[model samples]
Target chain A: MSKDSNIQIQINHKPTHLPYSMTLAQWVEHQTLELPVALILNNQFIPKGEWAQHLLTDGDHIDLLSPIQGG
Target chain B: MGPSAPDSWNLYDTPMTSRLWMGSSHFPNWNVFASACELAKPGFITLSLRRQTATGGQSYWKLIRSLDIPILPNTAGCFSAHEAIQLAEISRDTFETDWIKVEVIADEQSLHPEGPELIRACEVLIQKGFKVLPYCSDDLSICKALTDVGCRALMPLGAPIGTGLGLLNPFNLERLRYRFPKIPLILDAGLGKPSQATQVMEMGFDAVLLNTAISQSVNPAEMALAFLEAVSAGHRAFKAVPMPAQPNAQPSTPSMDMPIGDYRVGAELYGN
Candidate 1:
C-alpha cells in the first residue's frame, strides 16, 4: 500500500478530502452507498462498470445523484 | 374503474383512467405521503434527483416503486439544455423508464421554463427514445413547437410554480386546448385548491399534475382525496358536453296553453 496522502474531491459540489489514489468503488464504500446511484466525474458520467477500477485524484468534481421527490 | 375507465386516456402507449398526476414531494412525513398517495390514487407520480443526505435514504424510492404505480422522473433543477439532457438520461437509468418531465428553468424567481432550452433538450431526448413531457408556459407557439418536435405529452403551467395563483390565463390555456385537442395537455403547477384543478379539467385539459396543493395542505391525505374527486367530476362534466350559449330568450311553455288565448283587450273595445 502507498503512503496515505490527502486528495480533495467534490461530492455533490461539497469539497471533501480522501486518501490519494482512491478507487471509485472504495469511495462508494467509504460513502456507504448501498442503493443505486449515478456518478459524474469531472462533468462526465462514470458508469457503474468502471467505478470499481476508476481512480479518483485531487480536484475531481464528483456528483453523486439519486432519485428524490419532485414536482 | 379498474385501471381503464370509460374515459380512459392514453399517454404515449399507456392507458390511464385517472387524470391526476401527483408530485411526490413536500409532505410532512413518509406516513403522510403514503396516506396521501393512497387517497389520491394518481395515474402517475413525478420524482426528481438530488444529492443523498445523511438522514435521507432510498426509502422513498423503494416505497414509490412498491406502490406499482407509473413513475415520471423529472429534470426539475436543470438550467440549460445540456444539464437537462444529462439529468434526464441519468433519471432514465435510475428509474428504468423512458418517461421524463423535462423542466429547464432559467431562474428561481418565477421558475418559468426556458422555452428554447427546454425545446432543445426535448428534441434530443425524443431522439434518444424518451417519452418527453415538457413543463412549459401557456404559449401556443411554444406548445406547437414542442408537439412539432414529437414530445409524448405537453404540460403547461396554470400559473407560476408553487404560487398556487390558480390559472392566471384561462384564455391562453383554453386556446392551447382548443388548438391541440389531440395532444395530451396536462395542466401543471400553480393550482392551490381542488376547485382550481377542477377548472382546468373542466376546460378540457387531458390531465393535471399537482404537488404543493396536496402535499402542503393542512391534511395532505384529505386534500388528495379532494383533488381526486374534483378531477373526476371535471372530466365527467367535460364528457357530458355542456350546453351552448343562446342569443335570445325562448319560451319553455306552450304558447297555445296561455289563459289569454282569445283575450285581445284593445280589439274588443274597438269592435263597434
Candidate 2:
C-alpha cells in the first residue's frame, strides 16, 4: 500500500479489499472477474479496451450488474 | 426435431428448437446471456445492429452464433420507417437473415403501436422480400392493413411493454385469431408471468414475443423454463379444450360414482 496508491472499491454496496493503486484489469484479475458483467466506474460504462489504462485512485466505486430476467 | 415445427406454426419453417424470442437490450452481461438463452430455449434468438455498434463484428455475435439457434435480427430502438427500413437492410446484410421483428413505437406511455408508421415500414419491407412480423396492436383494422401488405404474421401487444398484464384485451385477440386462422398472430409484450404466456397460447395466439418478463426475474433462467413449459401447456391446452364452462355448476365427482351416497341423512341431522 503506497502512500498515494491505496484505492478503495465498493463492490455490491459494501467495502472491498482491493488495491487502490491497481488498474481495472488488475483489480478484476485479482478478483477473477469476467465480462458480460456490466462494469461501471463512477456509473459510466467501461468498454473493454479501457480496463488496463484505468488506474484507480482512492475511494473509487466499482459496480458489476449481471443479466436478470424480464419481459 | 427437423427444420419445421410440423404443426400449426409456419414460422417454424426453419431448424430452430426454441420458440421463445429473447431481446438484446438492458442485459447486464453477455456471458450470462448464453446460459439465459439455454434457459430460454428459444427456437430462434433476436439480434439488432445499431449504426454505432454495427461497424464490425460485435463481441456478442460469436456467443450468439455459438448457441446454434437461427438469429432473427430486429429493427428495434428505431423511430421512423426510414430508420427501421435501414436497420432491416443492414441487419439482413450483416446477419444474412431477413427474419425481423418490426417494432415502431409512437407513444412513450402504453407504447402503443403507431399503425400508420408500422404499415409504412411493413410495406417497404414486404416489397424488399423480407419475412416481416410487425408488432402491432390487437386492433383488427391495423392488423388487416398490415396483412394486406403481405406480412406473414402480426404480433399484437397484450399490454404495454413490461407491464405484464397478460391478455388485457382477449376479445380483440380472439377475433384476430378467428379472422386469420392461417396467418400467425403472436401475443407480443406485456406478459410478466408464465400464466400469461399460457393464456395467450390458450387463446390461440400462434406465438409470443417478450424480453423483460423473463429476463428481469430473480431467477431468469428458471423463469424462462417456466415460460417454455407454460407456453407448451397453453398450446396443448388450447388443442385439448379441457371442458366447456356452463351457467350451472358442474360436479367434478359424480353422485353415481360416489360409494358413500347410498344413505340419506335427515335434513336436521345433516344440516343440509
Candidate 3:
C-alpha cells in the first residue's frame, strides 16, 4: 500500500489496474457511467450516499447495473 | 355512443388510468416498442437491470424514459429469496421506483415462481419499503401469504411464463378473485391473445400484464391496441354485470301476446 502503488479491482466482471486507491464515488465519476446506475460491491449493494466513504481495495468485485428490457 | 371509458384503478394507492401493464421486452426494435407504447398507453411498463457495459442499455434507457410511463422492475432470473432481494434492491435504486415485480423461479423449464421463496423475498422487500407486486401462482394459500405479508398487489400467472397457454386454471383464478376482492389482482404471464386478456378482465381481475403476446405478434403495435381494446371491453362487461345463465330457454319475444295463440288453439286450427 505505497503512495504510487496500483490496486487491482474487477469492474463489471472485467479486471483492471487503478493508478492509486480511489473512493467508489471517484471511480464512478471517472468512468462517467450513465445516470441511474446501481453499484454492487463485493456482492452487496453500496448506496450512493456511501460511495464517497467506501474506497476501492485490491481484488474488490464491483458490479455496475443499468436498465434493460424485461417482463 | 362509443364504448364507455374504463374506471380508474389504484395500485398500491396510486391511481392508474390504464388497466394494461406492458412489458418492455422482445420487440423487433425500439420503434415498434415505442409505437406499441404510444398506441396502448399502459399505466406501467416493466424493465430490468443487467451488468453495465461501455454503452449498453443507454439507448434503451433513454427510449424508456422518453415514454414517460412508470416502471415496475422485475427479478426475472432469480432462484432464491436472497438473489431476488438483491436484485430488487438494485432495481429500486436504478429505476428510482419502489414498485417491483418479484419473480423467484423454481424451475427453469416451466419458469414458474417458487411459492415459498417468493413469499420470503416479498416479505423482505416489503420491509424495505417496496410496493411489492409478487408474480405468483394461482394458489390461494400462497396469495394469502403474500397479502398477509403486506403485498399491495398480487400477479398470479395464468400459465408458465411466455407459454401463452391462457388461463390454464380458471377455477383457481376465480377462487382468488372471490377470496381477495379488495386487493388488486393482476393477471400476469401466459396470455397469448387479446381475447384471453378480455376473459380475465371479465372475470373481475383489476388488470393484465402482457409481454410476449404483443411483442411476438406479427404486428406488435396493432396487437397492443387490440389488447388495450380487449381489456377495456372486458372491464366494461364486468362493470355492466352480465345476466346469469339459465338452465332452460327463455323467449325474448312476447310469447303471451303471440298471434299464434296458445298450444291448444294452435292444435285445433292445424288439426294436429
Which stretches of model 2 miss by more than 4 angstroms? A1-71, B1-8, B12-17, B53-57, B257-272
Residue-level lDDT of model 3, residues B131-230, one tens digit each, is 9999999999999999999997999999888888999999999899999999999999999999999999999999999999999999999999999999
TM-score of each: 0.85, 0.71, 0.92
Worst 10 residues of 1 chain B by lDDT: B257-266
- Please tell me which predicted candidate would have the highest lDDT against the true structure: 3
In the order shown, the candidates' DockQ scores are 0.52, 0.03, 0.66
Candidate with better lDDT, 2 vs 3 = 3
lDDT of each: 0.86, 0.71, 0.90
lDDT tens digits, residue span B147-260, model 1: 989986899999999888999999999999899988899999999999988888888998999999998999999999999999988888787778887999877886774656
- Interface root-mean-square deviation, each candidate: 2.4, 11.2, 1.5
**Top-TM-score candidate index:** 3
Tell me the spans in candidate 1 whose CA falls farther than 4 Å from its real position.
A1-10, A13-34, A57-61, B1-6, B247-272
Clashes by residue pair, model 3: none
Q: For candidate 2, lDDT tens digit of each residue in B106-160?
A: 8877677778889999999989988898988989999999999888788889988
Q: How does candidate 1 fare on TM-score?
A: 0.85
Please state how well chain A of candidate 1 matches the true chain A, as a TM-score. 0.83
